[model samples]
Target: MVAVDDMNRRILNLLKADGKLTYREIAAKLRRSPSTVRDRIRRMEDYNVILGYAAIVDREITGMKADAIVLADVEDGVSVRDLRKLNGVDGVAEVSAVSGDRRVIIRLRAHDSETLDTIISNKLIPAGLKDVEVRIIMEEIMRFPGTS
Candidate 1:
C-alpha cells in the first residue's frame, strides 16, 4: 500500500477542493515548496491514489432534469462486469455492487420523469435487473470532493 503521510493528505485535500489549483498555489497554501508539492502529487497520481480531474457539471444546465438512485437485485449468474454494460446506456451514470439487500445500485439521470421511468422499465429491467427500487433525488445535500 502507498503510505500517505500527513503532508500528502493535506495536499490531497487541497487538490480535491480545487483540482485546478497549481502546485505553486497549493504550496503557498500548505507553506511548502512548489517542487515538493509537485513531487508528492505526481507520486500519488502514479500510485492511482489521485485519479484524473474533471469539472463538476450542473445537470440542469445540461438539460438533465431528473436524477434517481436505483437499487435492484442482480439476476442469478450475472456478474458485476455484466452490470458495467449499463455504463454505456443513456441516463445511467454509475453502477455499483454495494453491500445491502439490493446488491446492485445505479445512479441515473435523464431529461424528465417519463424518460427516467422508461430507462428503469425498459433498459434496466431488460438488462436482468429485478425487484428494482428507484428513489428520485429531490435535492443533493452534499457532493464529496466538492459541494454541488
Candidate 2:
C-alpha cells in the first residue's frame, strides 16, 4: 500500500464521494495551497493511490432489482476462477479458500434470485458442492465503501 500523509488522506476523504473535486476544493478542505494539492493528487494518481474515478449508481434504483449471497463449498479439484465466471455474475466480489470444512466461499450478485440460483446450481457447486446457502437482502443498512 502507498503511504499517504495527513494532507493526502484528507484530500482522498474529500474526493471519495465527489471525484470531480477541483484542486482548489481539495486544498481548501485540507487547508493547503491549491498547487500543493494538485501536485499531491498527481503523485497519487501516478502511483495508483487514486485509481480511476467513477460515479456510483444505485443498482436497486436502476433496475438491478434483486441480489443474493450464494455461499457454497466446492470440491478440492476446483479453483476460485472456476466459480467466479458464472452467468448473471455481476462481479465476483471475493473468492477465498476455506480452512476446515469447505473449499471456498464465493460472493456473487445478480439482477434476480432465479439467475443467482441457476449460476450456483449449474456452475459454482458442480465443482463439488458439499452444501449451499442463500441470503436475499431486504435492505442495505450500511452504505457503500464509506470512509476508511
Candidate 3:
C-alpha cells in the first residue's frame, strides 16, 4: 500500500463524499491551493491511488427491486477450485473454507428471482456445483470501495 500524507487522506475523504466535487471545492476544504489539489489528484490517479469514480443511485428509485446476493454451498462434490471457473461468477468477492455451514461464500447480483435461479441452477451448478445454499438479500446494506 502506498503511504499517503494528511493532505492525500483529506483529498481522498473529500472525493469519497462526492467524487464530482470540483478541485476548487476540495482545495477549499483542505485549505490548499486549487493547483496543488489538482496536481495531487493527478499524482494520485497516476499512482492508481484514485482508481475511479461512480454515481450512487438508489435501487428503489430505479425500480430494480429483485436484486440479491446469492451464497451457495456447492454440492455434487464440486470442488471449490472448479466453482471458481464458472462463467457467470465475475470477480470472486470472497472465499472462505469452513467446517460446518458454507464452504464458499460467492457474492452475485441478479435482477429477479428467475435470473438468480438461472445463475445458480443453470450456470454455477452445471459448472460442477452440487450442494448449494442461497441467501437472497432483501435489502442492500452497504457497498464499499466506493466504486473506486
Candidate 4:
C-alpha cells in the first residue's frame, strides 16, 4: 500500500473537491508552500498514488440524458467485446466480472430511455446476456479524486 502522510491526505482531499485548484491555493489552505505542494503531488504521482485527472460533465448537457447500471448473468461463452460495442452505448464507464449471481456489471449512458431500451433489446439480448437488471442513475453524489 502507498503510505500517504497526513499532509498528502489533506492535499488529496482538497484536489478531490476541486482538481483545478492551483498548488498555491492548496498550499494556502494547508499552510504549506507551493513548492512543497508541487513536490508532494509529484511524489504521489511517481508512487502511483495519483493516477490521472478528468473533467466531470453534466450528461444531459452533453446529449446523454440517461444513465444505467446493468448487471447481467453472462454465460461463459459470451464475448465482452460484443457487449462493449453495442450501438447507442454512449459510454461504458465500468465493466466488471464480479462474484455474485450476476457475472458482469456495466455502467452505460444513452441519449434517452428509448435508446437505452433499444440497445438492451437489440444488442444486449442478442449478445447472449440474460437475467439483466438495469438501474437508472438519477444523480451523482460524489466523484473520484482529482476530478471535477
Q: Which runs of model 2 end up more than 4 angstroms from their true locations?
A: 79-105, 126-130, 145-148
Local distance difference test values of all predictions, in order? 0.88, 0.70, 0.69, 0.81
Q: Rank the candidates by lDDT, best first.
A: 1, 4, 2, 3
The collision pairs in model 3 are 73-131, 73-133, 74-131, 75-130, 75-131, 76-130, 76-131
Off by over 4 Å in 4: 77-89, 118-129, 138-148
Q: Which candidate would rank higher by TM-score, 1 or 2?
A: 1
* Order of quality (TM-score): 1, 4, 2, 3
Name the runs in model 3 displaced over 4 angstroms: 72-104, 126-131, 141-148
Q: Write the per-residue lDDT of candidate 3 for residues 1-148, one digit (tens) a residue.
A: 4558988998998888788889999998888899999999999998899988878766566554455444556666667676656543632234455565656666655456776677767666676554677777777567774541
Give a tens-digit lDDT track for model 2, residues 1-148. Answer: 4569877888888888678889998887778899998988889999999987877667777666566565667666766556545534444445666775555666656677777777677766665666777777677777655321
Q: For model 4, state the Cα shift of residue 49 in Å.
A: 1.3
Clashing pairs in 2: none
- Residue lDDT tens for model 1, 1-148: 5669999999988887999999999999999999999999999999999878878889989999899999999788877568877878999988889888888889999999999999999899888898899899999887887433
Residue 141 lDDT, candidate 3, scale 0-100: 62
Candidate No. with top TM-score: 1
Model 2 clash count equals 0
Which pairs in model 4 have colliding backbones? none
TM-score of model 3 (CA atoms): 0.68
